[model samples]
Target: MKQNLWINGESVETENYRPLLNPYTGGQIAEVAEAAKEDVIRAIDSAAEAARGMAEMDAHKRADILRKVADYIQEDREECARLIAEESSKPLKAARAEVDRTVMTYTFASEEARRIQGDTIPMDAAPGGEGRIAYTVKEPLGVIAAITPFNFPMNLVAHKVGPAIAAGNTVVLKPASQTPLSAYKIASYFHRAGLPAGALNVVTGSGKNVGDALIADDRVKKVTFTGSPAVGKYIRENAGLKRVTLELGSNSALIVDEGTDLSKVMPRIVTGAFSNQGQVCISIQRIYVYETIAEDFVSQFVEEAGRLKVGDPLDEETDVAAMISAEDVERAQSWISDAVGNGAELVLGGESEQQVLKPTVLLNAKPTDKISCEEIFAPVVHINTFMDFDEAITEVNESQFGLQAGVYTNDLQKAFRAASNLHVGGVMINDIPTFRVDHMPYGGVKQSGTGREGIKYAVEEMTELKLVSFKLD
Candidate 1:
């Protein structure tokens, strides 16, 4: 299949296309058009022009279109789900879940669009003047450039596009090159639902070429990027004045406090670590366990990790699937080897077959280990022991990224303390760090990202708040 770029509700066929493969079976999936720099410029210009039309559209109309798109997605749900699984290497169950979430994203953004009410400023109460009445209004930030990741291809695209369109902002989405077809499919879905031409576009190519052109363009007023910290920093440095919402990588931590039931928590941690082969931003990369139960927890967790079913994502019974590339697997293995060389004990799987790196667990890991400090965005976890709650909190908070944290504790005092002192964006009390429901205001506090991504929050981010004041006649 020739997956060309989408622009102005139309397809742009490129002269060159490259094959994309299913990581699990190493089979040809689809060929994506590699847009040239000129194509990028044309796309940006069209989307920028489309931004005017979108800005003029009433919020209700945009919301209605989104609602219609949501319905259409459900009506053609089977095809959408298959496309996601086929192009992105997402598991069947996860792909189905992602396909269903398109409705949720659109519906949430649609409701948020309708409810985009600006607050009235109490002018008389303020020290200004009794005769003055003041209030605020929300307006779209012109054009939006949405750069999505490959991990959760369909849902992540929805997270960016749903809000961009719902808030009456035209968007040019640049899906990850490795998994661009899913976003292309979504773009087609919106176009068929009567989304005004030029209102939404999709450009598929290398980030350095297409992404840089999109962000650097003055007409593109906002950027929503989900990727690595390095890319986030580059966008922030270059894309000035334009609103930016970055949901970047995280070295998330999970604290298994003393007295928590290991038997109960074992399966949860295993699933959390191995879900999507640990490609998620909030996957539990670091685990700090209380010393007393550390040994028992480590033993049980490793054993459970080994027993997990690993194979093709298309398999209904598969627990873990291949990663996006063979290079990613090798990088993960290298990190684990380095950690082991640095004295971290590998208690479980530390091997890779193709892109499928078996879920790994490390015990008695040191703080200085690379696996604990950096984002090992693979199915390898590092577990260390902490003598006290304070020490555990201290160790977890030392990382540069404060995206998310988890505390497996029943104590009211400890849970609250962990919530306060964790120095992360969101805290899960009984679950691992990978818990995200898609509608919550989710983002990191530090290097992990800037701004939040829930529908309401994204709507707010996509608009400019203008206040008007006038004297009563």
Candidate 2:
């Protein structure tokens, strides 16, 4: 298939094109237009010009369009899932779930469009405003630049694009070069749903070229990104005075406290650590198990991790698939080797074949080890023993990333204590850190990210509050 940039409600192609490869098979699946700096400029100009029209549109009309797009996605759910799996090497089941979540994201955006309310303030209470009525109205921040990542291509794009449209802002989307097909498909859905011309633009190309052009442009009012912290910091530094929401990387942790049921928690831990080849921002990378039950937990976790079937992503029963590329596999394997060289024990699997790496588990990995300190972004996890609950919390907080952490405990007091003490954005009491619905306030703190990305919360970031005051006679 030939995929081109979607700009101003049209498929525009340049002479330059790039091949889209299937990560699992190492075969060319399609070709997409490589957007030039000029193309990005045109997209930004179009979005800026169309912003007023989108802002003036009735809320219900915007909601209707979003709802219709959601319907279109549902109608073509299988094809969407297939495309995602083919391009990203995500397992079929997980690809389908990502599509479902994308649908939910748009649906939630539809609902939030109508509920974007502001507050009315009684100015008579203020000493200087005795006869004045003051209130605020939320207005769209003109144009938005949405930069998405490869993992969860459909849903992550939806998290940014859906809310920007719902908030009446025109968008210039810069999808990951590895997975631009999904972004093109989503843009087509918007077109079929009758979005006005120039309201949504998709530009796919090199991040330094297309992404930087979008970020440095004056017409783009806000920039939302999901990627590594390095790129996020660059955007923040260069995007002077523009509204920015960054969803960056993380090395998430989970604490297995004493008295927790091993059987119930083992399955979830395995799934959380291995899903999507553990490419998720909140994927479980560190496990701090209590000394009393650490041995039992590690034994059960290894057994479960060993059972995961790894093969082609298209297979329905495949539990693990290829990484985004061969380089990813090499990076993950290198990290595992480094940890083992540094005295960490490889408890289960640490094998790789081409672009696929088996789920790996490590024990006695020090806090200074790369697998324990950095965002692994692979199907590997480190397990360490903590003598006390406070020590577990301290270990979880030692990382620079404060994205999300989980605790598997039945004790209410301990759960609350961890919730209060853990220096993370989110705390799951009895669930894994990977548990995220479409409508929750999701983002991270510190190096992980700067803003929340749930539908309503994203809308808040994509808009600005305008205060209006009237003097009473």
Candidate 3:
């Protein structure tokens, strides 16, 4: 299949291309454009010109386009999901859900675009300011550079691109090098849905090269990125004066409090940790089980984890597919080995079992170790017991990377305190950290990077407040 890069609403193909590998088979899946430096400049120039004129476009026009984008996504649902699964190695079931999320994000952003209201000051009503009126209106931050990660390619693209476009800002997306095909298709779909030629552009190339070129360009007015903390900081330093929204890194921790039924909690935890091969930013990495029920929870979790089917993603019976590649599996195995070498117990599956890591579970794991501290981005959970709720919350919040977290507790007070004390973005009261419904404030605290995603919050972030003060003459 031929893959065309989308730029300025055109299906442009570069003379040069690079190989795309099938993670399950370790073979070339497709070839993508090694976009020329000149083409990159044209894309930047086009998006910048779009941004220049967008401030004058009516909000209703932008909303209408986003509505069209949503309709197109649903109309081409199956094909989009298939492409997502094929290119990103996401399980067929999971890929279908991602398509649904993509649709939801666009739809929500469309509705929210019409509701991007600003604040009105009461100066005119006040005695001393009878003739004066002051109010604030949100304006687009000009050109936005959307850099999405490999996992949930289409959905993340929707989260960034939908809000940027709905807020009347032109976008240039630099999708993950490993999984740009799905994103390229999204950009195409948006263009066909009647987005202006220069309003949205998609480029596929090296993270260090294309990403740097986009960030360093003065014309790009905003940068929205989702990646590792190391790269996020690098972008922040290099991207000067532009508005930045960084969604980076997550060693998401979950606390299973006492009094919750093990049967109910274990399955959710396993599915949350293993779904999408644990490539999700909010995937469960560390489990701080209450000491009272720690052993029982571990046993129940292990039993459930054993039943997860690890094999081909397209098969209806397959529960877990391959991890992006054999190399990622090896890296996960090495981390487990290093952890086990330091006395961590390998409970269920271990080593590279031909791209399927078999849902490994560790017991008595260390927090300082890579399995717990680092963003493994794999379906592996580290086990650790905590004495009480305070200790549990403390241990879970210790990591520098705080994205989303979960706690299973019947106590409302405990849940509320956990929400307040947990050093993360969103807290799940009775569910796993992986839970996301496409419209909540979705970003992280600390090394997990700055800024908020989700339709409404992202629209708010995509906009700039312009305070207009006027006096009646």
**Of the candidates shown, which would achieve the greatest lDDT relative to the real structure?**
2
User: lDDT score, residue 361, model 1?
Assistant: 86
For model 1, the stretches where C-alpha displacement exceeds 4 angstroms are none
Model 1 TM-score on a 0 to 1 scale: 0.97
Please give the lDDT score for candidate 2. 0.93
Residue 84, model 3: lDDT of: 76
Per-residue C-alpha lDDT of model 1 across residues 1-473, encoded as one tens digit per residue: 77888877788898778999877788888888988888888888887788778888887888888888889888888788777776667777877887888778888888887888788888888676789888999988878899999887878888998988888888888998878878887887888778889888888888877899988888988999999999999999999888889988899999998889999889988888878788889998998888899889888988888898887777787777788888888888888889889888888888877577888988766777778889988888988888889888999999999998999988889999988888888999888888988689899988999999989888889889999999996
**TM-score (C-alpha, index-matched) for candidate 3:** 0.96
TM-score of each: 0.97, 0.99, 0.96
Model 1 scores worst on lDDT over the 10 consecutive residues at 82-91
lDDT tens digits, residues 150-208, model 2?
99899999999999999999999999989988998999999999999899999999997
Candidate 3, overall lDDT? 0.85
Off by over 4 Å in 2: none
| C-alpha lDDT score of every prediction, in listed order | 0.85, 0.93, 0.85
Which residue pairs overlap in candidate 1's backbone? none
